[model samples]
Target: MLEKLIDDFKLQPPHAVLLALEPLRAISDYVAGIVGPAEALPRGDGHPVIVFPGLALSGAATADLRVRLQQLGYELYDWEQGVNNWPDADFDEWLQRLGAHLQRIHARHGRSVSLIGWSLGGIYARELAKKYPKLVRQVITLATPFTDTGDSTHAGWILTLLNGAAYAVDEALLKRLSVDPPVPSASIYSQTDGVVAWQGCQGKETRCHRNIEVNRVSHMGMVHHPDVLRVVADLLVEPC
Candidate 1:
């Protein structure tokens, strides 16, 4: 897999570089949207929490983050669908399945759930919020690419297929599914990401969202770095 990724990078460094810039621009725009009001952060009122993983990555790989959130009085839910495989159907289809899980959590706890998606998982969580607003109280995407998945390193096969299939960036679809500004979120990205360019991790315009740039962690390490854990804990903490 590593060799394939290197080959993919060599084959498409420009694409990789462009992909990197996309996130940086997005995150920059989002940060510019600051100086506004923030939505209520979900306290430990018993909403189940879900952590989605990056492309070719899963929640198990981010066990430390999950465990840390668990310590913060939040229940972490898994996809059961496995690491971000980039579903074959519309993102909404996956959202439907995810919505079911969110509903189940809400039923037991009587509060909306929060979504924390890493890399591709973060994109998944954002798409989920669009389709099922009532189901999600908030959204958090770590090093995720909302623009075009927006980085493609090891998922070359999937990317080729999506392009052949005329896969598009459904701006209308994403807009239709959009939630209120701020969404009480946090975006954490790194500069040393070897897989997806760090630029792709910087997010875009949104109210009440925090964009944090941490150095030295690789893409995978961001999934469990101690600072990453601290961000999660703080994001989940009740507002003062």
Candidate 2:
């Protein structure tokens, strides 16, 4: 299974058609939220939840989902840092800030906080769980490429250009990042993802780990997808 997943990770960029359709599909999903029937999922316990946006985007990219989660009784918090531009600063410094953010949330809530990250943010979420397992209740990723970063993303060239030497992914790092987090985690991906391949998004699923797929959704649209949001809500309500 590992070998198969790795082979599948020889990722390809999204097709022109899929890329072209992203805006329309995202708009449709947004419209559906208003005109379609809402799923009656159970409410959250008001636990503090922090959401991280994707690469090159901002916390505002996740606002819709965060607000939805908040409406469901979860205490939503932003990453605070404006845009997720990987090129602007040192990765280590960015991680330090995340660590501090997690600490603040824990201090305020008196409990481990759940983490939700999209794309690159998901990679951050997983590493955070590994470094501070006791402080993270659960981790949820939307279209995050974990198996191999370089080969998994359609935006590899962009990352290479922006991150320069830091974007390089060696075998040791790939093997390490592919491992599951110590806490409960789920990877939500789409086979037709236009940014990263679905195979790289999958990890070894165990009792506490899961890989979920939705049909016909773009990578960018995963953030607002109704089904994916439902899965996140369900996972958050589970016992810690």
Candidate 3:
């Protein structure tokens, strides 16, 4: 059943209804943010943390979570790359820019940084870890699809639309992308995720990599869901 879902590029109409409820869930998370305190998780050790927003979203999408992490005493930074629209330009050039940005963050901190990415941003974070393991202390991914990339995701059509006809990811790259990062990493996913298939969000169980599951969290709400936030906090404070 999971394999069949991954082979299908589209989601059922029922899933659309779940996606529609995201705005309300987001509002509730916002309320939770206001009424709750940052001490829900232990304070960080002052390491710099950078957050990457999901596809078609700007850093603003992660503002709430970033603020929470900030209050938890970690130096927080945004991707600052504007919207994560899959552009029509040379993909390598885009990656080069991203790599340079990560390099700059490492240089400035004078210590390895931790990366937290939401959805497509998580893919980028994992790839960065693959390329720059020494610069990254750990990684956290929220509701990211890794198994089949586009096909396994309910947002596959959106990716096809934005990324165009050449949007296919070869099997080799997919295999490479799904591997555990050199540094400690966690993939946080929700069984009820309305966007990506749950199976694709999993990692090989190992001391260095694991999948953390949350309940009743919408795909879009993962960024600010209280339970997801707590899990991220726990992962962040783990010794690397």
Candidate 4:
């Protein structure tokens, strides 16, 4: 069944030309974040929030977004795993470690923690929520292509370089990733994303799940785009 879906999906990565504009668009987004009307953004309830960076990115990459969240009254935390190059360790081991970290945070706060993740990191967020649903309040994914992990993303070469010839799609994993976590979740994506296919970034919307579509935001800019930030802020404060 997974194979049939893969065959029929025909997912393709965003155009190379569009990908080329990623850096410039990201810069524009950063600038827009600076002048963005954040005063109107909703405030959080001082709950703990952990942010997971995208593939090959470090906590620094999410610094701006974290700062914004912190200013909005949320206790922000880094993934503390340095760069997100998971190839250095066993995949299951990585997840176990993250789960343990989430457990500690939940225990410390005595409340469910919200998780915000970008790109591949979003996959981790969803999986952790699934494994430890009691510890998670909600989840928000930015430009994460959790539906199909085929060549639908331009990061395939990076994966190949990280895992070498050993890199192969796990159909079961893909299917599992596509499922929404038990907690309330929102996926913020853009049709103009220039890294992963937009289709792969969306899933069926239910009462507990929603898909938000932004416009003209580069994949790399998802973290700092003003529109993206506003949507994230609104969802974070929304009652589950």
Q: By lDDT, who's the top model here?
A: 4
TM-score, each model? 0.69, 0.88, 0.87, 0.93
Q: In model 3, which residue pairs have backbone atoms overlapping below 3 Å?
A: none
Q: Write the per-residue lDDT of candidate 2 for residues 1-240, one digit (tens) a residue.
A: 999997764656567677677778877767664442375867999999999999888998999888889989999999888877652545556677788999999999998999999988898888889888999999999989888556556666767666565466668767777888999999998987777767889988899899988777778887777777778888999989
Candidate lDDT scores, in order, read: 0.61, 0.82, 0.82, 0.89
Off by over 4 Å in 4: 1-9, 164-166
Candidate order by TM-score, decreasing, is: 4, 2, 3, 1
Model 3, residue 62: C-alpha shift (Å) = 0.6
lDDT string for model 4 (139-222, tens) is 999999999667789987787777665456678777888999999999999988888999998889898889999988988988
Better of 1 and 2 by TM-score: 2
lDDT of 1 by residue, 27-143 (tens): 443333232114332345445788887766566766766765665578877766665667767666767887787778778877778888887787767777766777677777777
Q: What TM-score, to 2 decimals, does candidate 1 have?
A: 0.69
Q: Which stretches of candidate 1 lie over 4 Å from their true place?
A: 1-46, 148-154, 157-182
Candidate 4 weakest lDDT stretch, 10 residues? 160-169
